[model samples]
Target: MPAPTHLLIPYSFRRKGILLGALLGILLTACQPRHEQAAEAATPPVGHYEGSLNAAGQPEVRATLDIRHPSPGHYEAEFTAPGTLSFVADTIVFSNNQLRLIRPARPGQTLALTLEGDFWRGALTLDSTRATTILVKRGVPTPSTYRAEEVPQATGSAWLFTPADTGTPGAALALLPDAETAPTAAIWADALAREGLIVLLLPPTDSATAAAETPRLLAAVRLLRGTAGADTANVGVWATGARAAAVAQLLTTAEAPRVAFLMAHNMAVGPASNAVLRELRRRKLAVLGLYGGTTASQRATALRNALGGRRGGTVLTFRTAGPDLLRPDGGAFGPGLPGAVVEWLQGK
Candidate 1:
């Protein structure tokens, strides 16, 4: 049995074929680096993530994140925090095992995170504050049961609480929350809603920002007026602490909308507050001033005197519910405050 003709192929030809195949393999590998291929394979799957924000000296704030990858290297995110605050991040970057999500705006915020296996750890920077946060893949996100519905506004979002008895014309109350009083505002909204008032809870803004957002506040008033059965002629604003001053300024402005009454709690007597008192006096707007007994007695007295027995203005004093009522943690007077507010609104 001598070798077949095909088996008689030259050794050089066989060697050439093997060499060509090896060269092709090398060229294919050179086109895509091994590490890059591994990185592409190691990308974390996009889905829902649940996390908590931990800041020293601050209570833990939990968050839910919905992440989506619509195309290669592009991502979108929606983040919800306490008090049902939600914002969407259209700009997200993921590269080199790091992810960055930003809500780009003046006083913009950012979250820079790194992937470690299945976990993502990061820090959220907002304004001048930074807090540590971590997210892990979640099979399902916890449902939010916040009672108030978030209504977007030009300045920010407002929490709206409409009374069940919306068929009858009733007063529309704009409750402005102080920096630490969002929860209190919710409580107020619920209590006021039960009393047949349509409440629009304004999110807290810093004093400086509040001073500049008069037009936004006016817009919110317009939004509230547009609601069915809302008494546009009897629109009232209730604000406590620093925001009261801002509200006063807003009401006093030439472009300010018509506000029939104002309820201010624990408002300090200063340039802004003084201006507010003067404006209320000039307009003869119904005013209810709630003050803590010890700390604000003088200022409250000054406010009352400024009104000088204006027909619709009244000042109420609380021995225990002074400035602390403006604090988020101070809720001792919550149960009692709402009753007083209801009575005042009814009296109006």
Candidate 2:
């Protein structure tokens, strides 16, 4: 006898259910790439990339790209080539494994690169020129660019940077914290050296007490005076972070003499007493005060007012520079900052 019609009906329903499941599987299979693409779009591949660019008839140019995501859906980037190119882009677009570096000016596209295996390879489109570029993610060392020699001091060792072209280069003692803790400070010293300034980068102590640290700083200053390529007559002090106040104190010390100028970066003037300002003014110190961020203008103005219009007291506000007196990426100085610093030094 044939099977009951009710059983056959149930079997037919089971077959339909299997076909429905197959259709759902196909739909999910088709949507998998879309889901993955959405995920990729949400999380951009932002990083620091260092590489070289090749143009049709020009020398190969070394470049560095820094992409940062400070907030949700907000991105900032910096592209730097020591002698070739430099720009900071606040607007950039990343999609489908492609990155577009948008210029704030007309003809928007600056660099159009695609994510390849361990590299961002593409063309740099600037004006009428296009260059083939390949970048590998790497941490470019800060002090690697300049030649440094260790000069042992009573307190510690100082890295001496002498200019190759100038026998008597303008000297500045960098009062920085530990290099491991503050790498940007080391970069600042290297940047000054790159501009042909003789820099004696002194090792910082654990203590920030002016009275305790001034002696060591003064000893390093004296050592800078005796250094072969350093110009003792034009020696100055470069201070950043908490060391700025101590540097001001150092200048007031009896042992500290022949200190022609003082360059303070990102220093809070609130910690400095009025007496210190008065003394600095009495000495006719050539002071360059640089403050950064939103309150830069106000801080700079306050410092200027504290100086009471002392000669050679030039205070500038770099809206884009970080607390370290360098661009956010720490790859280079802010707009014309290095040149302005060098010009001021030459005048002194």
Candidate 3:
């Protein structure tokens, strides 16, 4: 009777016992632990997220996560949208199944994240700039710390305080009393306060000689941005000079100095017009031009064609014409050309 068993079973020993049980089920799934087989192949979780427009046309946001572990790698998640981006909890870390997060900056940018656990599931990928960050991995789920807005400020009535570089902080100790100017730009603000560069002049919110010095020059442009990191603006055409050439001809029309001061060595301001230099290159600034006398090669050819387009904006000209050392002559430059455009903007 044993000889009758499947005609003596020799179909190559039943195809080597089903290929040795499929090579021991692919060597126990390649010996597990790739974030636990990507959290057991994203099982029984939840997910959904969405956003729109990017590829530089701007706006690309995301967030959709649904997970439930209740233990082990520990997780509980849900979201459809609620991420402006912020992180720190358990320093978030993952591998293979891939997930990562890191953000915390004590003075400027430091946002980060990595994605693909179904970016909010349907869609969510915001990145107006540096794109903030995001990610979710393995049993995938992420969304927490998405409420941190506070950037709606204006302090406007006029302020100007810029300088983090440009002729190296020579002018812009902030101004706005009709944006100061007169004779070579008011002796380039007294040779940029005798070359130490720190002036806070004021008087024109429509000066009746600024009754009691325009609230002490608008309290030094509103507390010099919590003191010395400067950079403030509340302008309508405040001076950088040819008397803010009609607010530098409406800063060549629109978006004037949201932050400006590029370079001015091949200098400018022959009374603002080429249609106010094309509305100051379509209202975008942060330009500076200086190249020795007579509007230096047309302020370095209209700041090299309005900062060479696609608007990443800025222009800082000076391959020469700003080192005559112990300068200030031509009746000491100022008292002549708007006090050398207010001592090259107070950095004299």
Candidate 4:
């Protein structure tokens, strides 16, 4: 056979090379923002610190905290950590080199804390939570010099929804709208229940946002669980996409409710996230994944191959290529198509 001119010519190869490079450049530029956003979300906005508290007097309350760098000499400040804090105005503030948290006071819960952070670590003793108490001591990195910049408000509709306990909820269903848009997946939730799984709709949010929102999300999950069947001992919890932080949380510690499945999309996790996932896998809980955004097709292939190799396994996915971000509030998140995640979970 005669050799093809394009194959024999060096210039042809160079043209292809240039085209490949151009495509790659465009792809990289397009992808950098999303990855950067993901990384950013993974970061807790620097100033607001978060930790759980067993005590909040008022059933409804908001919390906020502000930590700042003071005069570049010694870092000192004050802020309130309010419960049910608004995501719009109430932010985890850090400024003027001061530590301050301003949260709405709850009835019967006069608990508050005055925090101090320096180069080494921070000390947040309860100024009011329980007469006086000290919070967990964490090492703080070197403080940065103050730069006047407008702190952006937290965006998205992914609400915090933590359930009360490990029980079935009532008829009322808890729907978590994706930060980008509200998912109509509530319809699928009912279908999921038939398969011995209870779907916990979670909107997409990253670590920084999840830190404060996790509690509220958990609270809602707890609320919905109360509506489950009055006599089932097994309760399954489900979340998708970036909204998996609460599940990520429960896994980090031993406090997660009895779960049959932890359905997540893309399965993107970070250092803290990996810590949580490892813990869940340790507990023998199923970590199921559907079609997600990672282009390395081998990842899904590996997951399927790995599980398929087992004697018996549950799959939290479909033959689908990608997941969609269908928010209840009309906003969309990165990369996944929000199809029937609930159905996918219930093995439909």
The C-alpha local distance difference test score for the whole of candidate 3 amounts to 0.31
Q: How far is candidate 3 from the true structure (C-alpha RMSD, Å)?
A: 26.7
lDDT of 2 by residue, 1-348 (tens): 111011011111000000011111211101111011112233446678899988788789898887654444334456667632454442356666777664322233378888886689998876676888899887532222233444444454455555434555566665555433254454455556667777766676666657765655555566567655677777778776567777777678785656788887666676454568668988888888878666788888777877775353898888886665567652357777777877877776
- What's the lDDT for residue 323 in model 2? 60
> What tens digits encode model 3's per-residue C-alpha lDDT throughout 315-338?
333223232211232122311333
- What would you estimate as the lDDT of candidate 4? 0.34
Estimate TM-scores for all models.
Answer: 0.53, 0.57, 0.22, 0.36
Candidate 4 local Cα displacement, residue 200, angstroms: 5.4
- RMSD after CA superposition, every candidate: 20.4, 22.6, 26.7, 22.6
lDDT of 3 at 238: 34
Model 4, which residues run further than 4 Å from truth? 1-177, 190-210, 228-232, 269-275, 292-296, 299-321, 325-348
Candidates' C-alpha lDDT: 0.59, 0.59, 0.31, 0.34
Clash counts per candidate, in order, are: 1, 0, 56, 75
